[model samples]
Target: MKTIGQPPFYSSFFLATVIIALFLGISSFVTYQQTPWKAPASADAKKNPLASDAATIAAGKEVYVKECQSCHGKKGKGDGPSAATLDIPAGNFSTAATQGQSDGALFWKIEEGRKPMPSFKKKLTENQAWQTVVFIRTLK
Candidate 1:
């Protein structure tokens, strides 16, 4: 039996409630993903100690393959094997949004990662992380 005052299956009020809930859910997801990934101003000022030469980039590539390729993709398009499973999509190095950030900012981010992306400080030496930045440049 139906309730005396409950919403019917297709009532406008019921539909509106469902739509609002859906919109809120989608908005929250977007907000979580679009949250800024910024480093401190001090980090932004820091320069890359390593050169952008072949050897530097090559060394970076090796590390990236082991540590990052699963998420950042083979060419740094953020389309790697595990990307689909992540709540936060991997960053694409080819885009201007990534390239626009300073090298120091990149290093800082690698050193102190936000949720989803792990902080490489413990896993990689400072030089290694810097080299990874150099390699990332080539992806653009």
Candidate 2:
């Protein structure tokens, strides 16, 4: 038996609620799209690690040529062939301003490249990444 004030089993109210929920979802999505992306804490500049030797640098350089030169440039000056067409732009390793990065910071950046650049964490070994960090510090 139905109650005195109860409506029928089918109702327009259900449809309205779904529509409102979808609209709110889309609005939230649009707002999210407008927000800018921030770098991860690992990318922080303060924790940069330094490399200690010529051998490490040389090893890093070899890795760079094989893995990074496409975007980071031959000397890390960010003049590589692909650098010109990148939407976000590549890093300039040759400049002193760029060289000011800490070793750990550089290592972090290489391990997890910013957007557009792929992460080498899986492709390259941790040691290889550190070697590359050593090479990057020499880019003056």
Best by lDDT: 1
Q: Would you list the C-alpha lDDT of every candidate in the order shown?
A: 0.92, 0.74
- Weakest 10 consecutive residues, lDDT, candidate 1? 1-10
**What would the TM-scores of all predictions be?**
0.78, 0.62
Q: List the lowest-lDDT window of 10 residues for candidate 2.
A: 32-41
Q: Which segments of model 1 are wrong by more than 4 Å?
A: 1-31
lDDT of 1 by residue, 1-114 (tens): 769886776798878999999999999988776777878889988989999998998999999999999999999998999999888878789999999989999999999987
- Candidate 2 lDDT over 25-130, as tens digits, reads 9997876454433345556654424446887777888898998998888878788888878766575777655676566666676777656778889999988988
Task: Please report the TM-score between candidate 2 and the true structure.
Answer: 0.62
